[model samples]
Target: MTIPLPGLDLQQLGPEQSLRAFIGWWPDAQTRLYLAEQAVQAQVIYGGRMMHADHFHLTLAFLDGSSVSVLQALAENMADWPVPAITLDLTLRDVFEKPQVVWAGPDESQRQALTVLDQWHEDIWARLTALGWTQPPRRFRPHVSLLRHARIAADQSHRHALPTQAFVGDGVGLIVSVPGEQRSQYHLAATVNPGRAVS
Candidate 1:
């Protein structure tokens, strides 16, 4: 059975804001710049914390408050797990006002890829659950966050056209993130790709 380690909680992780691990995809340089531009614009115009360019990603699964021990255990358990590589196409933007954030996600045309990604997420969740980890409560939403804790005008909120962007990730990865001043910062912990050697 997997033992939950509370000692390494976000509060225990010093100044970082979150105490969770996640399966996520980091964007390539060009994609990062494009996304950062959007986040920067939102922050500058609406007043909010801009996500650091280096940490731009689309989350696959949110592992709620897993401590170092559990994460290490899970990493070891999934050391050789192969995650297929996929190119996610995102072309729409929206503001989740209650949470005060801006994000972008795939449009209808990209539904096939999004469906595969969602299935991949489910498979991962099942594996982790079998390994003794508790399931996360939030439903999966295949989107990359731009600016968090944002304050946007009503007219500026909700869905709109975002320029086309695509990223072909090498593999899936587990990111270790902690709470940050402006936003939670992330650290890539474990990753695997059936398409290539384990990284």
Candidate 2:
């Protein structure tokens, strides 16, 4: 994961202001470039609005409509959250019908990394619950969304195959979603490095 520089002034935010935010892992430039290339190919095969490279991320927790105070608290306590260093292999190309999205996810063969990631997800949610946030009941399905509004059938999702690509994920960031005319723009608010001592 890339350590993102602050893009929003959290200190300037008013207490009642609500933010559409989430904590996620940002890929390094090289990995992002690779994903962008894959997205271009996927768009040709799948037909959809390809997500911009800058918008690519692996979401951990979606905190929609979170109050400024809650966001601030999360940022302040971020260093205390567990961030296990893991390597994710993006080789599974698939689609979700409800959202009409094409995405890349780790294949089942990456057991060790997937296990660590699963535990880390649970740990983060445990910390979030202490901050008065409720964990969503939905199961965690980790994937990097590549295209939206895709017009591909379910079986066509496997028409194209991805070569083995791996990236080290060792950090997390708080990102605010800014709605745009075409798609939502994401702004990095704060980040915490992996293996930092918990306060």
Which candidate number would show the highest lDDT if scored against the true structure?
2
What are the lDDT scores of the predictions, listed in order? 0.68, 0.78
Residue 32 alpha-carbon offset, candidate 2, angstroms: 0.4
- Which candidate wins on TM-score? 2
Cα-based TM-score, every candidate: 0.79, 0.88
lDDT of 2: 0.78
CA lDDT, candidate 2, residue 66 = 89
Question: Which regions of candidate 1 are displaced past 4 Å?
Answer: 1-19, 153-157, 179-184, 194-199
Q: How far is candidate 2 from the true structure (C-alpha RMSD, Å)?
A: 3.1
